[model samples]
Target: MDKSIFTTNAALTPALGYSTMIGLGLFSLALAYIVRLYLVRNTHDFIIADRRIGFGFGVGSVIAVWTWAMAVMMSSAMTYQWGLSGLFWFVVPNGIAVMAMVPFARILRRNMPEGYTISEFIALRFQQSKVATGIVTVTMVFGIILEILINLKGTSVVVSTVFSIDWRVATIVGIVCVLAYSYFGGLWTSVMTGTLNTLMITVPAAIVVVAVYDRIPGGAEAVFSAVGAADQRNLSVLRPDAAAGFGITLAFGLLAATVADQTFWQKVWAIKSRDVSRTFLWAGALFYPIPICLGMLGLVGIGYGLVPSDFGGDIAAVGPYIVSHIGLPLTLILLYVLVILAACYSTIDGASAALSSIVAVDIVKRYFPGTSESKLFVITKLSVLAGGVIATVIVLAGIDFTTLVLTTYALKTSVLLPLVFAILWPRTNTIGFVGGIVLAILIGMPIYQFVGELSGTLAIVAISGLTVIVAGLLKPQAFDIASLKDANGATSAPTAGE
Candidate 1:
């Protein structure tokens, strides 16, 4: 909280009385055009860079997409709320990432050559059945919408605060910038921008962490030692009090989710070689650690007299807090703007591309088999555009972090989780796979809606687990097992034709 380079109003103002929002808008527009020039093309290109992505780009997107406003903010928020248990949110995901990489990747890389989405993967490998695809699609699309909305809200608020403008304008400005860039370059542009974003955010974030700590009382050690009273119970990987209070049922919801996250799956399919995908796994292994560092910073804030005493503090404040506290050199301000854009758009673009690609290749072709590739491509792009509009609207509706997280995780609970678990466990029969999904909806939806799990994690674990169990107990169907085995066999850079 020292050095003087970022005078509040000065940094917020544009030179020569420029329309800051409009200038930011144009800057965003230019970025989008550059992305389009670098990337935009067919549906296949948009979804997985036509399966031509290199190591750094793929690694960068995979990482950036993983850390949106929620990921970064929530990790800190959790730490603020629960002390060490908060760290589990990040740790679990990394653990889940490792859990997924062992059996999932090689087959995923081999089988889905131009993999567009989770729906396409399930449809192509298992049944291409309407029931199956519909089930997965509904959950994934909704989850993505929730994720996007949360990110939009975070970015909008940050921009609004920094610029002293209305949040709504910030939201519109943010979305337009992303949509414009996405409109131009497509996936190529997004990935390139994503890599730049990772670097932009990482450097400042690391520095902010170090600088903030040096200034804080007792630094990290004092913060950690003092964080003990924040937790009501032992810091279990699965918090039992929160678990029972919230009705959590699945010990591995995070694991089930990682298996089906379309963001990372697209990354898996984009890479040129199976080995490059390994780079992502390594990156993922280390991905959640950033949250821990960020969370620690939040604890430090509490340790110092910096935290407010009047009301309950919010840990999501780690962003604005760090940026404000880290005085001097002022580069962090510029760095944060870049990070916000990167974190927000990297996921949004990838999500848009995945949805569009799946619709173009998998959904449209199935219904209108005779449609030409060019026409299918148009339809897919249009669908993506539609999805973008819808997602933007959802954000406009205004959802809090708890609502956003619950909406996404619960939806995934009823549909995608069962499907993913079925894929992961060899013994899971198709009957079980299908049944589990349906049962998850019936059981989870009621709990999510009527029981009001609200923001807690319990509902997600329970609903998803019940679905798998119910589905498993149902009559096994004559599934096309050979295809799955074939896929698993071909996971590690199997011949493209395999």
Candidate 2:
């Protein structure tokens, strides 16, 4: 619980942090524009990269977009707070969330090959009921907004801490950089930058662990001893406290969260069909090391006698605090900068693309049907800009990032089961999809806040499924899956170079 040990050390300074931010930011932005010159030419290219994305970019997109700053920072914080078992609880479910998307991605591509957003598919599915589309649109929008806001908060806070810069300044610089690259190619920009980000995070993370190994008081053995001394179950995968508190809840929460994300769904439509399953599976497997490796900072902190309790409930500081004290060389300090920036930028650009896709396809075109593709493309770019600006405003307004994310996710669990069932089950009707989600939002959220996350999430998902089942029994409206072939206007255009 003492902080005096870190006071004398200086791994990085404000000037270095600022230099890294501007240099990396400009380089990424310029690279995005250059890639855009070769790829982006139409709305089709912007939204889904002309549906020709290959295995490498697809896997990179999956890994990078999903590796938000919260994952990078909080996983380490949780490890510091809860011990070894904490890594398993956070990492496994996160992977399952992406892996679970494999089957759904294939199904979605088959059913709505030209789909712009999942909300677009929902609209096509329940043509007679506007409520379903409305539900999907509203939730997905809020989800993307909260997604961007939280990552921005995480990035700015970490950058501010390490660089001794103003959080507001860090946020503006980061958002502007994200907005620049994202404006160039939309989804193409996201995938390109994401690929770069994946390399940035993975290599640096591996290096940091190896570099810091000797700094631990007694090495791995000492770290393990401290872990057990803190709590024996810290080394076990089945920590009772973790399971009851967050393990199961977070698992289901991430499942719901990923299912409800437009960013992942966008990739589902973007990747080539033959490669969909492989891409998702590879991403799932590769994504594990990011959070797990970063978590060593926490374990090493434990070995060095700095635990979460020492930070006075702000466990988010544990990662930077560890790095600051360990006497990291200049190279490792710069490497740490890339890890954080990449984590934040990847998701930020992905969110921009996802929100713009929805705005252009679902909101703008749906409301103003006569708009031309050229006009829609312009609107989409503007939406990307607007999404970045709005999230920045929210972060600057001083909202609590964690609470905003939790609130957005609480709404998603209410609708997740019905949304999934709507895709998989023939008996799911508009009545159930609409009414169940509505009631769950009204009722389940209160329970989530006052009762418990696990109980509330389970209750809402059950209520949603039950409502659909009951509606099917009462007045079944059989849906024709064959109709989905024509659902997204027409068959998708051929892939680039096909």
Best by TM-score: 2
What count of clashes does model 2 give?
0
TM-score per candidate, chains pooled: 0.80, 0.95
What lDDT score is found at residue 486 in candidate 1? 57
Question: What TM-score, to 2 decimals, does candidate 1 have?
Answer: 0.80
Every candidate's lDDT: 0.59, 0.81
Judged by lDDT, which candidate is best?
2
Worst 10 residues of 2 by lDDT: 489-498
lDDT of 2 by residue, 1-498 (tens): 233645524646778887887787788878888778898887778888888889999999899999988888878887876777788888889999989988788888887777668887787778736778888888898999888888888888888877778999999988887888789888988998899899999998888877777655566777788777766776777777877778888887788778888998888888987898899999998999889899887776665567556543578878876775567777886788788889899998999999987887778777786777777779888999998899999999886676767667766887788888888877788888898888887788777778997787777777877888898779787887668886545422222331
The per-prediction CA RMSD against the true structure, in angstroms, equals 5.4, 2.5
Question: What is the RMSD of candidate 1?
Answer: 5.4
